[model samples]
Target: MDLHMNGGIGEASYASNSGLQRMGIMKTKGVIEQAVSDLCRNNVNFPKTLVMADLGCSSGPNTLLVGSMVINAVTNTSLEMGLKSPEVQINLNDLPTNDFNTIFIALQELQGNTTNGKMRDVHHQPSCYFTELDEVNKGNIYLSSTSPESVSRAYLEQFQKDFLGFLRCRSEELMAGGRMVLTLAGRTTDDPRVEESNRLWGPFALALQDMVFEGLVEEEKFDSFNLPQFTPSPTEIMNLVKMEGSFTIDHLEIFDVNWEAWKIMKNDNDASKMKEADDGVGHGVAKAIRAGIESLVANHFGEAILDDVFMRYGKCITDKRSNKENQSLVSITVSLTRKCDI
Candidate 1:
């Protein structure tokens, strides 16, 4: 039940339906800028060639957005310091099923003679999760408030191993004093079962329950499926970094984003009109979730019900919004530097 984005530019493809994720990335641009600036300013032994990597970089417009920003930051900082911008080696890594070709095409379109002789060298690494875990939990529902202790323990153990492996690998690649900025969906509370951590999936599970009631999907299947995702709290992340002892956290910030923040509409002054627009915020969020997890769902529950399942999921989101429920997603961005003496 490995999860990957729906590829290419189709309706459900990550390319067409990742505005929420893009917004999250854009919100962390300040942190990324600060990290790059600090890396350049504090590391006097900085090499003439810079290497940067974007982990879990899915394809689409947002795919190359960060790289472009890094380049701009380096170039501007160099000018401010009366030095030349270093040659940048940018690496984009994601699951093998990701659309690297689409990303490469987008990169070509975006990087046409704009590197300013900085020697922009781009590389792509097709990989899955940094570490392996049990497949049963891959696409299943996450632990909720009522979940037993054993379930929570299993999930936490898996995350610990995966995250530690991830840090170890990056520690080997990054030079001493090199910086990395990472952004991911995260929970603000240490408790994994909090509403902020599982709200989106709670409604999604209800939708599947409805399907089970209607005999559209098997009850056993619905009960057994779980999402392979985990949203760590800032404390959890800090603990992992301390345990790994290879990277030091420079800055860690959490952001709260409304589910409706990604809506794109031309009628800025027409709230009523925008509410009735075809691509409402609720539907957009549902589409983004579907794009990320539909393949896994299809694999387990059969592809025939994907359309119905996501359609109901969208309605659930809309209903929640109408009821004035809190539908915010939490994001965590952390800046880290390799330990000089590690």
Candidate 2:
């Protein structure tokens, strides 16, 4: 696993919560609430029934924030159905190398926040379990990774196979009538730039190129660089789930999130430090956005014209902030659900 990815667990939390909020995902939290309410209504009389799971749960505000929403959804639905609340098993998952410490800290904060219905008893804690995919059992909620963009064609095929395996494994754990909600960065499958499109990455690549031109990063290392896999497309995801023949799809909607705030922050941080006077390496804010959006320049464009390239892509993504052009962002989220077969 790459450090960029391992470190991205936290970054994913930050970006998801921030980008979603900026992009209006908070508005769709109601969908989960409504779905849970409906699910409970159909199965209320079953006392042993397990309800939901938040898979790929990161340890951060999103973990708690989204978990609270799920709990409230179940609580309200349980009330309407005249049944006891179903146990919500939130699984905070990551590679074995993820910083458990941060996740632990976030979990601790969720310990006694009873207002959201997570802490049911003063003595017993919420039914929160931590598991890697390898150890996951049937009945856990499946949340997908938000960070990492996929590479070119060959990698995408292999990536799909692995993701299918993961989905199949987790689908086996869900109880019948149970619902699993997963979020992924979504783009149209037929887009020619499918290989290069990563909502979280458009900017990072630009910044790296800036550093390379400035002699900060070695040139050879750039060749070996590859982005992580994003959720390919809604069609592709649907096909994968259908192929499983275990879990049935419930809902799938795409939300375009505004990532301008995060983009601004990253640019600000880089610009402040990258000035020639400082010992720190900072690529100018404008240049970073350019590198992220347009890594592959067209023919006949030389490195000498980098500034113009930066400005062009920068304008496409930026919104006016403080009468300056530093803030720029683009992101989208796809929400999907799979029901467990009894």
Candidate 3:
């Protein structure tokens, strides 16, 4: 997979602008904690040495946060059972392009720091689509109303081919009784091309279009590029899991949170601070997006135009927001247990 988040600890890096993703982690923390707690409590084959893996754990504090939470859950479960805490191991996997230096530093700093509920066990850090729905993505990126039927079918076909591979690979890696808590951007409707189901790809598309108009980006290159991604509906996920036949779903839930809901969830109720943040909401949104996809965009379009592109993207966000249009981020979270070998 040519997939990797923007690296580094700088402002535009994924590490700095990952608050939205961190919010996802926070939103699902309770469910994740409960899943781990159940595994420790109910699994008769629970090992004294525990191994936890966070797949696609891109750089930033959030990676550590996930590790810490899982470790804490295991420790808490053992304590409740009046048993000694298990030897915990963490395996963080990301593309080699991710910023491992940040995680390494965080791990070093977290040693013997049990007060914060972060991971204290230092395990080795390992390094680890959008397709051409572009015409419809004209409004912003992602499938839009005008997307043709053929294009949509192409997307589904590609997802089927790729996701099945993903499932089969993970199935082989996980031990029997291993649990995976997956949270991804998903659509509630089967027809993601509908305007209502578009994820937050708006401003970026506008920026690229503007650049293309100004002769800044080659039309040929832009047209050829596709983000290899698909937002599977709940039914689609169930079918895929059943088709793969390696995991059984223990729980599933769909969540739709307003774009600004995560900010409020921080409980930073200070009006002045919120207003200050609101003032730069455009810039903030742009930076957050740039952090996640700049690498992909840069890879396709080159890095020269990124600053100008995202600057325009920020303005696009402000303009869109001004129209009183709002969008919610929909997440499909599932808890899966690795099925035993027959």
1 against 3, candidate with superior TM-score: 1
Candidate 3 on 1-342: residue-level lDDT in tens? 345777777867777666667667777878888888877877786568877888788877677777777777777888778887777777888766677777787675444433334443544444323334434323334556766676677778777877788788789888888888998788888887865555466566677788899999887766655566678898889999999999999999988655553232222222223323553566777787788878778888888988999999888877877755565568889898889972
Which candidate should be chosen as best, given lDDT against the real structure? 1
Model 3 is weakest, by summed lDDT over 10 consecutive residues, at: 262-271
User: How does candidate 1 fare on TM-score?
Assistant: 0.91
Provide TM-scores for the models: 0.91, 0.63, 0.87
lDDT for model 3: 0.71
Cα lDDT tens digits, model 1, 261-312, are 5553221222223334475566778888987888889988999999899989
Model 1 ranges off by over 4 Å: 112-119, 130-140, 264-276, 323-325
Candidate 2 Cα outliers beyond 4 Å, as residue runs: 3-25, 47-51, 111-151, 192-200, 261-342
Pairs that collide in candidate 1 are 138-228, 139-226, 139-227, 140-225, 140-226, 140-227, 141-225, 141-226
Worst 10 residues of 1 by lDDT: 265-274
List candidate 3 segments past 4 Å from native.
Answer: 109-141, 261-279, 323-325
What is the full ranking by lDDT, best candidate first? 1, 3, 2
Measured with C-alpha atoms, the lDDT of residue 105 in candidate 3 is 74
Per-residue lDDT tens digits for candidate 2, residues 196-278, read 24433444445445656887544554434444344466777778777767667666776554333233331121222322322
